[model samples]
Target: MAADATKSTAGRTVFRHRLSTRAWHWLNALTVIVMLMSGLMIFNAHPRLYWGHAGANADPAWLEIGATPTEGILKVGALTLPTTGVLGRWTDRHGVVQTRAFPGWATIPTDYSLAGARRWHLAFAWVLVIGGALYGVASLINRHIQRDLAPSRGELAPRHIWRDIKDHARGRLPGGEAAARYNILQKLSYLAVIFGLLPLMVLSGLGMAPGVDAGWPWIVDLLGGRQSARSIHFLCATALLGFILVHLAMVVIAGPINEIRSMITGRYRLPAERA
Candidate 1:
């Protein structure tokens, strides 16, 4: 009777995210949100980006957010765009004109306080680092990364990747058994985020910390310099933000309830097998 029940259940659902993965997923989500908002607030302190070892108001910046005699503008490279009310200048709820890189609504306290924002940012940075480390260990021990995220030889083929891209463009997702497994694109995305962007974010962030740099000057040197590290950190943050937006959109397109439930409960109801 137990065997029969197991077989019946297997026909409808599959174990997708593990308990550890689910926990890390939600926890990481919270920590990343806190980090992003607070980081933006920190950026408000210096709304400019530059390349090379050292940069200041005296030097040329690759990017700057400020207001001209006419209107607020965001200057990047050789282009300048009007960004009033979003980037350079905007009016607060009290009808007072304010100048900041990011608007108040987009920042963590929704007010201008770099000190308060740093506290929140640092606190969550620890959480992300510790949680990511544990998740990495668990993934290795459980062979979850190997079996699920690592692309197979066949999946690594260009044809396979192109097919996945076309399918995604056409809003066609895998069903049944295919749906239960990660596709080539999904595997690559997860690998990039986990191994590439996250590490860059952590290292570049440490590079910006005065205390961390004092202890490990090599970190800042490896990245080129303090200002360079700051620019790289901002770029990585922007990439991560893009990933999050795409991830949420894919979830909604693929079936938000089932996709979300799988992350929350570890049981995913597989779509009907395609003919």
Candidate 2:
């Protein structure tokens, strides 16, 4: 049986989040937003991606976004998409039409500032790493990972996993005492983001930094070199962004008031048991 320490009930309301969890959740939210925005600005400095150790403007890019005299375009291999009012070109706050890959509003400083963007990005990168490390240790010490996230053998079975997928697709959320515990899908997604995606993002980020790369050349080498690391880092960030969007949609679907309160005040009103 899954342990639900935070779900111990008083009538319909249950304590649903640890202080550590809530703290980290809020901190991570702010951190990721800043990191993402600044990273976009950084990427705008060179809107091209390649696979090898070295890449240049002259080299072929697997992906590229740029503005021609008439329109903005994003090219992925041979495929191209016109993106005039977004992506490769957009009007900034100053009424100037900008040709940056990402618009100013979506970036830090809201202007073209590679050095400024890198500073903001790198600072928050450390916050993410340190905060994540502390939260990881705290979760382990408190058995949150084991009790909440580690799926049982039965949950891992193909049939059980498929059923959860179907339920989610149909908007069938867990209810009653079941609502007090995470569904298998929630457990798996949380586990992947916490363990797999985040760590790789950090490592790939380090591989792209000149200082880190020079100090630990192996990091870049392991990822197939600096250019490859940058590409992988971009992809990982894209995945994380996707995860955040879906997670937000699920929160809205599952009663945002209750879900948000749980992370804020650590109390949740369990959904009524389906009759």
* TM-scores, each model vs. reference: 0.94, 0.94
For candidate 2, the per-residue lDDT at 93 reads 89
Root-mean-square deviation of each candidate, in angstroms? Answer: 3.6, 3.4
Tens digits of per-residue lDDT, candidate 1, 92-181, equal 778877878788888997889999999999999999999999999999999999999999999999999999999999989887667888
Model 1 spans > 4 angstroms off: 1-11
Task: Using TM-score, give the best candidate's number.
Answer: 2
Candidate 1 has its poorest 10 consecutive residues by lDDT at: 1-10
Candidate 1 global Cα RMSD: 3.6
How do the residues 21-114 of candidate 2 rate in per-residue lDDT, one tens digit apiece?
9999999999999999999999999999999899999999999999999899999999999999998988988899988999988899698999
lDDT of 2: 0.91
In model 1, state the lDDT of residue 255.
89
TM-score computed on alpha carbons, candidate 2: 0.94
